[model samples]
Target chain A: MSQADLSIPFRRRAGRAMEDAFLQEALTIATTKFIGLRREAFDAFPEGEGLRDRAREIKEATLQHLDRYLEQLIGNVERFGGRVHFATTAAEARAVILEIGRRAGARMAVKSKSMATEEIHLNEALEEAGIVPVETDLGEYIIQLAHERPSHIIAPAIHKTKGQIADLFGKELKRTVPADPEALTQLARGELREKFLQADLGITGANFAVADTGTVVLVTNEGNGRMVTSLPRVHVAVMGVEKVVPSMSDLMVFLAILAKSATGQKLSVYTTLVQGPRRAGELEGPEEFHLVLLDNGRVDQLAGPLREALYCLRCGACLNVCPVYRQIGGHAYGHTYPGPIGILLTAMLNGPASVKELAHASSLCGACADACPVRIDIPRMLIELRRQVDEKRIAPWIERVVFESFGWLLARPLLYGLAGRIARVLQRPFVRDGAIRSLPLFGDWTRTRDLPAVASRTFRERWNELERETPR
Target chain B: MTTRAEFMARIRAELGKTRGLPPATPARRPARPRVEAEAIRAELAERWPEALERFRHELEKVGGVFYRVATLAEVVPVVAGIARERAARRLVSWHAAELGGDLGPALTAQGLEPVAMPPGEVASAAERQRLRELVAAAELGLTGVDLAIAETGTLVLSSGAGRPRSTSLLPPYHIALFDRTALVESLAQAGVFLELWHADGAPGPRGAVISFITGPSRTADIELTLTRGVHGPKEVHAIFVEAPIRG
Candidate 1:
């Protein structure tokens, strides 16, 4: 949780990833394939952009009246014969889940990919209670076996190579496994299948909680989540309070945008909605269904400009497309959520003061916001967080002085222009191939890209020259 | 209880309501219009022929076999074939009249029993429990795609009558028949289709879960290895049912 511990070192991770030629090849190949496939999915339609706009609008409307829908959701859940509990913190959320596990006398939990639970560290808490929790997402399950945290928001183990995966299987699953992605998936299925059958509890995250019918919509490519909810006698869904939308009409927007942005598909392979426990008329749902709605700093976000953070669908396309996330992978972020979204989420949830170090993780290049389907101005938010960090005086003295100097100079055009000319002249020593090379102050920025040289003639100088020649 | 708005007002008052952030200011517009939908689609189609080809290619990539049949009548024999191959006896199915008349009679003739039940009439835990047992025991779970996205070779079905939401899930093997005409290449088109059908109510899909299933249920739970059918339907049969050739 400390700042030093939290620096994502995305550039460093990316540098290492680049060095591992095999991994670089895998990542490039996979990312390229998926991005193209995603584009194709959108291309098949004439109204893709409009669909996204509609979806985003739906999402906004849904979240605007979220509280009302949450109430309706509670009412519907109760009416449908489900139990809903509200939690104010990670401890409370964990307590509710563990209590459910205890009451079920559950020894193991099979979990779907739910960032809310990860934010609460549900697995560690459950393990402390002497119950093992298994992650069933292909990416999550792989990382779980390695005892590592998720790397990307969606593609958790995107940084891992096929060989690393094959080795993990060979050693842990005790069989020769191929480097094939298919073989890897089959291995996970074989292993989780038994757990699904034996586990006493199913813990999942809700993608969207529809208030109209009290349905918990869970979308997954793998079937593990469905089993986690249905097979287990006790099903516990841990979701953020913001996850609930008011109606099915509102739910459509998220459903449309979520998978498209996340996996670049029309939809994932599986989307299941559970209304409540095995209704009197239903056959296969959990006997007891419990929903734990965690506030855990989201309420604070709702009150400020940072509320856009809540609108994040966790699609992870932002991270996939983010230059920063591509480099560090997910683990170096040192939080449950990773990438641009993870930085903001961890900062808000862990108490922004504690995560001031993460405030500078991104370049204000605007790609994260650009890739964001919900249109969250991520860079602007990061800038705001940076400002807060400085105001709180938690930012290091050196950084404070740098931005302060820049700010003061920018306030006076004359001073700024003079400084700019001076800096261009001073850059001779660092210039390599017309770009800065190995500058002492900020080497990371120059490490990959050539910092383009400032034009020889400043705009002011040219403007003055033109004025002198004009008749006026 | 106080009036609904009054109740909310009281909570806000008790909580010490204060003015919050100003509404989001609109950004300055770029001179050129952002590309329109048709243009984007045409660009996508032109620039991404290989990708478009791959989209359909990948559908067959992940253990999903999609058929491109012309008519709904062709649906019956395909359903019957799947049932016969699975050697299914008690079939738990959704309410698709097309399937019942076209496929059900064929299934019955083939000695494959098809029981199409109304969704959610199981009034007690015992009945519900029995239904769950049937899902696990049944040979094949049959249902119709509310809409299918060709770009990903996905089947979209929400729970309703005959589709005992549980029947589509929880089964070992599931065979879904979709129309090729139903296939839209992009999520944008998929969105429009959903919008068009938005108000056409089917129990409001209360607990209405829109499932966009691309292939059979799969997992990689053990050691970062892949396996199919961990929780939901293990084997999925997607019959694309392509539109019939014009004479």
Candidate 2:
């Protein structure tokens, strides 16, 4: 996201998305379709539930022994003649990759759809250094051409219409193009095919790095992942530390569930596992392979509060099921990642202060948890983040005061009853249609949603009346 | 730059703080993968007809074309027919040794330009570049499947001496030849084969990549409109030969 977009408060950004007629319809259709697809996928696969649990366990197990696994991964990668680079921060990651580009004399780099690379903001740095970074995935290519960040995790261009895409392509290629997906895709394929063959550097993100065999796995519906890794002279894979798995067996468990959760496929069209650079007899593959192990903020979360968030598969399922995301879409979240999980990730990456407003973005419906293939318990962590935000004084004074006073009143029955009566007396001016349309200093809440007027008769009053009327 | 030592130390520090958490272990791998794999192969040898039926159903479900032939020689006509339908004249294929036989001459006889990749690395970079251009320009790519997953109708191809990755990738149409030998019932069984392949150590003289291709490349990114042939083959064809090509 750009600094200008980030400057807008979350509420205004969300309001803008809500008011856009096209985006509203697109979100409804896309999320509704994704929800149905995911449901059908899991409903047919009876073992999906058990596999979810096992996948979660595998993630936990891997994290528990992360040091050892990473060590083994590093050793084996070297054994396979692949270099391993460590990046403590995003800057270091970009610097390492830029140095590699400089050494390789790379004029251009072809990149597959990799959130890791996006998270690190690698493209801007590469461009500044005079190396062209080409996003090869169809969705990513469209967004890259428009100079926009991805709005969705897997479907980066879901927010865009065919007409908009036609315009973008026409502008870039300087030719009139039709508003048809097939024609647009073919045009992109033709444009990127030459870049694939000509690029000197190929960059990707590992979906899972097998520790035992020293392999980096990439899952994509498009074949950009294959093209990037195979054709370029140098291939660089940027991956978070949490992406490593123990063995090939563990990888299968994930493969079965990942696509089912993301796009409801049994498996994506391509699951490419590249171990290292081209072998001696291999006709085509990168000659030099580099794996960059990134820690930016993931290392702190190993023992931190956001630990379970590490198990996220980047499937975008939570986004589909999230009420907030469905209404406002990914852009409102104002971060690299956007969804229920994106809030926690934003908190993890930027700090608790950054997500003070974002933490309250969820309605605590827990749909994200239920839809999660690994069941990350997103709501539970969200509540924790909210508490941390308040405790750290990141929340506004009014919110803290209101919540604290409510907690105090609820703990004392007499005070709660007294307060309810006082509130009913004070709410007469704003209470219409048995709901509060607006309230002094709380109009923000009532602006979009109605607050139920303190009941005409409190539940306690109704209980007392029932007791009195019952026969002895 | 973050040195390996400092990075490991930071990870250790955080890991040290995590204690008394719930116990968990990774998925259990097959204890003796080689033995287990052989047992699976033997079991599949008997039930291959059912597996093949399921594979065909699933493959077609994902927009793949399937063919059944009585013998390896019968696959030639099917390939020619596919080429004729698509008007694809140029083809690149794995080496004769890797493909189990040389179909190049027969394919050429059918009025198609067919080239086979060298079995080993080319001695010169210029020659390698030339072969890459050949694969890139060719409309049809032919290779052999290392494993054909019945559960998802996926064809697993491991890159190696004769099998250049682009033979199935760069071309617009990918046709893979396999028999009961490569058929596996599920991804779990495929896992066993993978474990067995890498059990002792690295396999001898192989490429550095293995691709599990479920179908042709597709995307629904633009307005959620599904489109095929984004960057990989637009059409994938799998030919099942009843008689083993190796025999």
Candidate 3:
């Protein structure tokens, strides 16, 4: 779908996704496998639980004094001859990176998989400026060819079958290859290797930045992080302000648990720690280094209702466990981020008005909170967002009216009892097999689910009868 | 465009709005990193055999081949045998100083064409480009491990003079040689060594990058089917030298 597809109502978009049989089957298999792997990985390591709590505390501590750590980060990066730029918005971030590319005389840029770049839509901006942005990560490369957004955080192309991927590659390379993962991967390696060696600029997102050592850490299984940071003449890393940690000691605590939560590995294949541009005596590295600290709606949440969201590691563990996401997948969320945490993040990056429909997407089952490595209370914040939506009058008039009248009745016992008695009579015609299968005014809700019929006898009536019969 | 002052000021204002948050602190850094690192070294001196055993188990679990050689001299025969089995030639290795011994002549005597990287940076862009081509075309990459983490079967290599990052990347086969000195029991112990490197006035890594490689490069992106060597080495071989090469 193009950007115009976003104009469709979120409900309709989600409904369409539900109709896609391939997507449904793929989502079930992928998420189920990820959940099992994460469980097995954590089960083997007894220290994982304590490490998770420690990681959570470290995130909070760093955020509480974000200013000091950021300043230290800036100082250390500069001390090592790297330039730092501050971008308050996505547009500014794009402009800053474009300027860097222009200054470096870059013709083609190679990139590793980065949600920050996806959030800013950097590839389009780079293209407009006449710099070809090549995504080197295999999964991201497939999506870029298919002209689609990532459907999963760690595995971007899971929505695609090997046949579909082989077809996509055939379209790109103008030649047919066998529909096999190994063949497709080798072909991509060969194709992207030439780009890596020839690209003038390399772009990436930092998994975490060490404030004390001025190091930007990138975790990947494909080794593209190393290739991008090493082979190009100029390197640029864009990161959210929340990615900064205090020291290398703090960084190790996160590394211990990051891959386990994301891919169920003890550690990712490659954890590259880059301090700055090429240092003296280095044969191959970028001549210029730029670190862009992006604040695009993140700074507001430092004290806003979504403050805890800044603690997210972007592991996608919550997405796997979320019942809604498992059914609809990522693109149905109709934004850069998707899933339960994606709702809060979308609200953080956009606004509460942006997630008016998305706020109600969750079942509030608390499975997401349990699966979260940092133990973020996602359901609690989701309820807060729902309340915000209702208070702002963003919900439809019918919903507001129903909920408002329900609240009024709940506050008054006499009216509540009388209304229940009236509902029992009114519900008799619709009630069948003890369930109201359809309702005239609530067709949207009743179409997919059945509402329980009102009881034949009111609870208050039964309670009074019991009280009268009791000897006491 | 946002100035640093404006950006930081906005953050400061938001931070001020928070009140009565729970008390929290970051992980406690070692007070004296160098001393702590030495202490770890002293403790490992007696427990290295156990650490090495764990390293072998974890390494094999991740599909890596493990070999133990009594001395650095024996590394050549193992390398030759691996190359012979795979019918691979044209190997690239770190400079003799970085590898702790010169094996170029011995490897050449075994009928393999080995190229050692220059000890320092090549001044010209064209020369650097030529060197990169050689590394990229070589079938095997040979280098020394700075830290071999046993708990996770990870090899940590720092890029510097004679130790280019691509020595272990951009090749089909990667063979890393390490000694007892480079072994660490866990990531926490490696943390102490990392802290010691970046501590005040300490001589940290000579280059700007440190890579922790657990196994061969892999991806399960296509239908969740595991495939190795997408953009890095397909096979990783770690040879442990029972005698310290640095000595």
What global local distance difference test value does model 2 have?
Answer: 0.93
Candidates' C-alpha lDDT: 0.68, 0.93, 0.93
Error of 2 at B184 (Å): 0.4
Per-residue lDDT of A1-472 in model 1, one digit per residue for the tens? 1111434454454456456665455456555655665667667645667656665555555555556667787777877667888776789889889988999999999999888888898899999999999998878887787777776666667667778889988998687889887766656766886787678999999888876567788888776666787677889998887777655545655666677777665667787767777644333457788888777777666556566788888888777666666655565567777778887888778777755766787887888887777778889888888888889998879878988988998999988898889988988877877767667767666666678766678888999999999996
User: Which of the two candidates, 1 or 2, achieves a greater DockQ against the reference?
Assistant: 2
lDDT of 3 by residue, B61-158 (tens): 87799999999999999999999999998999999999999999999999899999999978997898899999999999999999999999999999
Q: Model 3 in CAPRI terms: which quality?
A: high
Q: DockQ scores for all the models shown?
A: 0.19, 0.86, 0.83
Residue A198 alpha-carbon offset, candidate 3, angstroms: 0.4
lDDT assessment of candidate 3: 0.93
Tens-place lDDT per residue, model 3, A1-472, is: 3222778888888888888899899999999999999999999999999999999999999999999999999989888989999999999999999999999999999999999999999999999999999999999999999889898888888889999999999999999888999999999999999999999999999999999989999999999999999999999999999999999899999999988888899999999999899888888899999999999999999989999999999999999999999988999898888899999999999999999999999999999999898899999999999999999999988889999999999999999989998998889889989999999988888888899988887778899999999998
Q: Go through the candidates in order and give the C-alpha RMSD of each one to the true structure.
A: 7.9, 1.3, 1.4
The clash count of every prediction, one per candidate, is 30, 0, 0
